[model samples]
Target chain A: MQLPSKLIQDAVEEMAKLPGIGKKTALRLVLHLLNSDKEQTTMLSNALVQMRENVKYCKKCHNVSDEEICNICSSNNRDKSTICVVESIKDVLAIENTAHYRGEYHVLGGIISPLEGIGPSDLSIDLLIERVSQHDSEVKEVILALSPTMEGDTTAFYISKKLKSCDIKLSTIARGVPIGGEIEYTDEVTLGRSIMTRTLFS
Target chain B: MQLPSKLIQDAVEEMAKLPGIGKKTALRLVLHLLNSDKEQTTMLSNALVQMRENVKYCKKCHNVSDEEICNICSSNNRDKSTICVVESIKDVLAIENTAHYRGEYHVLGGIISPLEGIGPSDLSIDLLIERVSQHDSEVKEVILALSPTMEGDTTAFYISKKLKSCDIKLSTIARGVPIGGEIEYTDEVTLGRSIMTRTLFS
Candidate 1:
């Protein structure tokens, strides 16, 4: 689309660079900012700049944090013996929101996606091995909470192989039909897995 | 959702404030930014700030511009004798994209919507009247190209009443079924209007 103003066009272009936003949606957002109070735009810009400049990754877990270590990694209440391995910081947040898991997290940064040219080296897998193998480490069990995608499974298998000599138990989160999912609508692979891994009734 | 970092939370909150963006989508965008190169985030933030700080509205037509007057208003190629009035800057762009109209535009900024508490004084109506009534004005026609909504009609009627004393002719954009619209699915009001105002075939 041909924009009348260069400033708006620039802003729209920047907004369109986001993953899901397109030129039309970016234009709508830019126009909204232009029409609204100047303070709102200033606040948004400042917040984004501050996030980009001041945010840090947890040295231990690779999760997004304001400091060298994330809050979960530093907290005493969290179970340091069990580290939930996941794809990204978003997965960490999702697990945290459940409020059921008290274990610390290890963000892999991403899964092993060969299609995207992302391999084990592209992720923080080496950091995970180093973290678990550290002398005087309290880690006992490493839970693989990665997604059920093929790449996630590959990453998990790779991590399990690396941790084989570390004297740590390796486990993966259960793969089954979702709690409220209908049997008829469930995909064949998931349904088959759910049937094969049927749990005992209490 | 509970975010690990305050900076991430702040950015997500600001993003969620935009139209159609929810907290989850905001978080997703923020995470994508965090995972990508820092330069991308910096560029987006800088573009937004620059757009907000430097952008200006055309003094003549109220359309967004980088200067005092918009390109269309300043261009000598446009017809100075005809003025097309629209509700917002987007409308001005939409009409310009058609390339059928050669006249300059007068952006009302908004329509008269009592439900939204917007009135005539809140828009640029007075400036439009003043421009049309200028002693040295060459304006001969004012086209009301506003939307066909009730608020648009009210605003157009209000403008027509205001410009009744001027020597310029006043006209409105024809209301009819859209070019590619299916007749069976067309709304009754639009279909009725189209039939009532049907033009003779040459």
Candidate 2:
């Protein structure tokens, strides 16, 4: 829709650049900002710029950090021998929220999606290999915790092939019905595999 | 949920302050920005700050503008004798999108809401009256195009009372079943009102 003010139009266009935000929603958001306190708007703008300018990535895992080395990598309480590999920082946050896995993580930055022109070279796979090969490294097991997509599986396979010569054991997160999931609604392939790979009760 | 980095947390908190965004959605948007080119983040931040700093409001209509007098108020193509009153700039854009009305607009900035502590004093109601009172002003009709809600009606009623002595006409937008609405699923109050205020075929 046509807007009368150039400043409003400019603000809406910038906001619409965000993912999942359309022009209409952007206009609504901009209008809300226009009506709100100017200091609040400044705070938001400053926060975004500051985050982009001063944000740091972990030297080891590549996750976002306030310093060169992330807190997770420096923490002595974390299980350094077990490393979980995932695609993005969002995945790292998601897994951390679970409070289940005590192991550290290795962010791949992205999966191996040839269709999208992303390959093993585009990711930090080599750094992972280098980290595992170090004689002083205490890593005993590497867990592939990527999503259950074709790209994730392809990346995991490539990594497994690369790590075969190393003494470290390779494993993957279990594929089965999720907790509180109903079997009747579960897809056939997942259900069949879950049944065939059933584990003995403790 | 706990975030690993302070910078990421600050960005997320600032984003979450927006009208409809939650912590989860804010985190997703912030992470998307972090993963994207740094230039895009700078552009967004600059646009927002620039808009907030340079934005202006029309002297006549109080709609967000880039100059003291908005383009709509200065345009000779629009009907100078008719003025459409609205609660916000968003309503002005919505009505302008219809391309049916060629009249000037007076943005009240907000409707009178007691629960929100907003009263007629907080609006630009006096400026609207003054615009209509000036002898040189050719405003023969004032149309109330506010939303069909209690607050809108209250604000309209107050404006009508204030304009009682003025030698001008006051009008309100018609309310009925939406153009393409299903009658069966429509609420009874709106349907009954539509029937009670039925108009003759054109």
Index of the highest-DockQ prediction: 1
Give the C-alpha miss distance for residue B12 in model 2, angstroms. 0.3
lDDT of candidate 1 over A1-202, digit per residue (tens): 7888999999999999999999989998998998889999989988888898899989999988999999999999999999999998878877888899999999988899899999999899999999999998999999999889888889888998999999998999999989899999999999999999999999
Residues A1-202, model 2: lDDT tens digits: 7788887788899899999999988988888888889998899998998888898878898877898989999999999999999998889888998899998899999999989899999998998998888999999999999999899989999999999999999999999999999999999989999999899999
Per-model C-alpha lDDT, please? 0.92, 0.91
The DockQ value obtained for model 1 is 0.82
Q: If scored against the real structure, what TM-score would every candidate get?
A: 0.97, 0.98
Model 2 lDDT vs. the true structure?
A: 0.91
Candidate 2 regions with alpha-carbon error over 4 angstroms: none
What pairs collide in candidate 2?
Answer: none
